[model samples]
Target: MGRQSILIVEDEVIIAMELRETLEHLGYMVVGSELRGEDAVRSAGKLRPDVVLMDIHLKGEIDGIEASDRIARSYDIPVIYMTAHSDQETLSRAIRTQPYGYIIKPFNERDLYSNIEMALHKHRVKSRMDGSPEMVDSAINMIAGAMVITDPQGHIERLNLEAEQLTGYQLSDVEGAPFFTAFGVSVPGRDLLIEKLLVSSEYGAGSMISFPSTIQIRMKSGGDLLAHLSTALIQEKESLQIQNIACLIEPCAPDTEGRAGGYQGAAALVQAIPDPFACVTEDGGVLLYNDQFSSLCERLGDGISGVALPINRVLPESFIGSLAFFHEILVDNQVVTREKMVKYSTGSIVYTIRYLPVGGDTGGSSRCVALHIRDVTAETLAMHHCERAQGESQNTDAAVEGIGDLCTALKEKVLAMSTAYEQGLAFHDTAHERLAEVNRILGDIDLRLIEIEKNRWV
Candidate 1:
């Protein structure tokens, strides 16, 4: 393959020149350089470079994060952020953009090369996987429970953020490491079960194995975690050979049976709701959801077959922003309501989501939050129509009032002219009668106008 091409986007001229020199020295083709975010976006479209080295601060209206988001969504280009600041707020915004890699400023040649190569490799892998690896990654990270994906031999390929938190091992530390060794599992017949599942998957006999009971997990922090473990084999489409094993680990409370019974009762109660309703833990895990919620998930292209999954995984991302205030609901014992406009291929939908604290002390910690979603599309549309109609009616009334004023002025002028004609004409008697008739006609017309205005609604 030819040398990978890169674009440098930095406002500082000195840093931009130094970056170009380093990239060229590392045997990379520097396609273009820009000092502003807007220029960088235009250059990305024109040059179509393999990777972009973006600086967080830029000299234009938009910053690097915004520019990178536009480029990724519009051109599907990979961006690696290079910044001097390491503040949490900056990092959080950058992570939302989903940059391929992030390198702090004053990075070494080796660091630059590695980030570029990794970004290229990941982009290639995503393309090979039908261009949805980013989506899959987002979905995985959105999951409330810890999840790990490993090769058939049990070597780790990738794991989500929750998994990293649970295992206390980052992806960089455990990539290609044996899963069983990295995080110890204390389930009986765990090895035998994995071997059997692998063998069955290889021969196309079975593709999944789920453990219903809770198992003990030896945490990296030297604490024990009780979790429900389930695994499924991801197979190659045509070959039917196992490519990877997906392990879903949901942490459970010690009172598992009692919690299960409570969930069952809650589920029965929520089933009576006509709208989409769900009860989620404070940590965003679904404890119980009604069928309408499940159907809504399916319609939104996120189908949920079990509880304990993350609410983010089951709902659209646009709607998840409101749930971020779940803690506030718990603490204040207040019902938080938000409305979101979701556009579908067929039409737009307006949903009102209400978050209420469920059985928690006032101004104290809460265990669960009830999420109720109502389809308010029709109601919203009707309200808009009503407002529009009222506005038009007001406009019409104003126009009618103006015409009424004009008619009254014209009537008074005609009456004054008739009185003068009746007084000055030689045949004053006949003219007086004619003027009387004209005045009466004008009065009749004014009365009719008043009646029309008064009965406008009718």
Candidate 2:
């Protein structure tokens, strides 16, 4: 980081003097001038220079190559090999130390300066690359965060052990899947992410808004996980930002069932306890509708979910964006609470809608979000009159317990392994109906094959 110091270990006095002159001219401080390999190693230990310039073929059995390796390993010093022995055998031996740079004997001052500068540059770059793991470990490992590094094409590269363990899909299963195809959630601003990402000119064009958003994704086991995501391009090339996406899930707490999701999965239980629930996707469409949810709104159909539901049916179009509304039951993904409300509804009907993240294949582009709905319209209103509302007092407990239970349940469900896996599934209304349906569907083609018994065929 500071002005670099170089330790010169050339045995030839003239060559050593010449190299020192060249290094000094190139804005480097000559820390030590040594003739013997052992002396050079000792001097390097004392000087603790920014770098070491060692000549490979020394006078003793412990050559410059061995001395350089010791200097590097012991003192964490950067070494550049400088020697007249440019032959294949000697050069191969010198390279074992992974020296910063290699320069042949009787090199010119210009070449010498270039090598020194190159050595420093290489060390700096190496330092930068190697610093990341430690930095990442310090920040993410203890706080329960999931860090995913991806290639330019969005294939999974390296996921921390925690991320691999939580998602239920190993790195081998998910490495090269397309980001969208793997994660399944339709990215809200795919055109924008690719807008500048796939092209050279617009890579950093406008003031891009960073969404501190939470979205849901499904796991390899078909259950969903709630991931808190902050979407940004980490490493940028000319056209593409080889991204490093980070996620920190608020650990879901223990429930009445004596379970807890490691992070935010605990609160989803309380969020699911109420009736008349509907989930809205990030793209502003209805994702699901529970049975009681459909009945409350007078809409009933088997295949009513997984499609956009019009929001204008319940509240006036202009009221949707009104800022005067507030809820009593809203809780941060990291915070657990019981009685959050959606006060924006007409007639002031309060509903508890707990949000969860559903990560799909790659997990960063969360595909689906869960809305655990609980209708608290009447209780919420009655509490306004009764100063000593019991439910209101336990609002925090109910909300926390409810969401926590569901989240814990879901977390277990998401990571569960199934041995009773079956392929063909058939559903029917009644016992007779099921038999009839199966028989009709199979037609007269369904005949049992005879099992051959050994020797005793009666």
lDDT per residue (tens digit) for residues 1-458 in model 2: 56689888888886787788878877888988988888988998898998888888788658887898799889988777765445555544554455655554445444455456545543555444433666544443433335455554556555556766766677688777755466544434232333333232223211111222334555778876654333223333222233343322222323333222322353344234345555444454554545565555543232333246554453333433211121111121221214544344354555554444442233234443444455667666655646545434455455545555545554443333121122223321333343454444333222111111211232
Stretches off by above 4 angstroms in model 1 are 1-261, 360-364, 416-458
Question: Each model's C-alpha lDDT?
Answer: 0.71, 0.51
Colliding residue pairs in candidate 1:
none
Positional deviation of residue 267's Cα in model 1 after best superposition, in angstroms:
1.2
CA deviation > 4 Å runs, candidate 2: 130-458
